[model samples]
Target: MAEALDQARAGRDAAGTALVAETRAVVAAAGAMSARFRSGGRLLAFGRNGGAADAAHVAVEFTHPVIVGKRALPALSLGEDPSTLPILGRPRDIVLGIRPAPDDLAVAREHGMLTVALTMGRRRPEADHVLPALSEDPLIAREIHVTMYHLLWELVHLFLEGETEA
Candidate 1:
């Protein structure tokens, strides 16, 4: 029990550190995402293996908000095959990649879409914004990614509502 508790505490500490390190980038990305959505843009998320699940999760969160009264936004998960991105993506769309292929991000950038990458390793993919998980454990890294995306969703809504009032 002590071992489990220690591991959990370590994971929490790592998550907090990673989030703090990337706070500025996350805020900037959320602002950009809000702008894109305000301009009638959709969010296209893609990943492979475990990342595919994350992509779908992100899409559902935006398209089907669990919180009542919150606006639903357009979002789609491309799953493992990102080849369709070129066909489905639009200039105003936001592309979210979780450990995605570099070429896919490049294509999204070329098409004038906003690109955000969630990575967990030494190699960082090119994107408008990159959030890298600090933990070496895959499970912990995934937790960090999940938290980061949730933050993005929440902040995007905050920015969107704020802009509406302004």
Candidate 2:
């Protein structure tokens, strides 16, 4: 029990160190992405298996931002709601993969939206831009995913105004 506790504490310490180092980069990328989302465009995030869960968590973070003191940013999840499931069902929506067609990439690029692709392999896409994320080791990736979003949520609050009543 003592050994396990020490290991956990060490892990937490390491995570905190990584977070502090990468906060700026994460903030900048999320800011650009957030701008695209706010400007009449949607951030289409996708991944497989646990990556999908990370994608979903990111989608929820944007759709329902949990910033302590900020306004909610406009975000949409491709697989979150049954209503928009139609969008995904249709071939028109820009889907992420190694070789998403130029036309499909254009669909997203033309809209000035950010295409956030989360994959665990070497299938990079050609889009307006890409934010390469870590997802190889599931354990660490999931932990990073959680930490990344939490920081992002906090950043949202840091940048935007507090929530308001409709």
Q: Write one digit per residue (lDDT tens) for candidate 1, span 9-125.
A: 987797778679889888988999999999999999987547999999999999999988789999999987778878999999999998776676998898999999988755488
Report the C-alpha lDDT of model 2 over 72-118, residue by residue, as the tens digit: 55444444222233344222232332223223344454443344443
Q: What local lDDT score does residue 114 receive in model 2, on the 0 to 100 scale? A: 48
Q: List per-candidate RMSD values in Å.
A: 2.3, 7.0
Q: Which residue pairs of candidate 2 clash?
A: 71-161
Q: Which 10 consecutive positions of candidate 2 have the poorest summed lDDT?
A: 90-99
Give the C-alpha lDDT of model 1: 0.87
lDDT of each: 0.87, 0.48
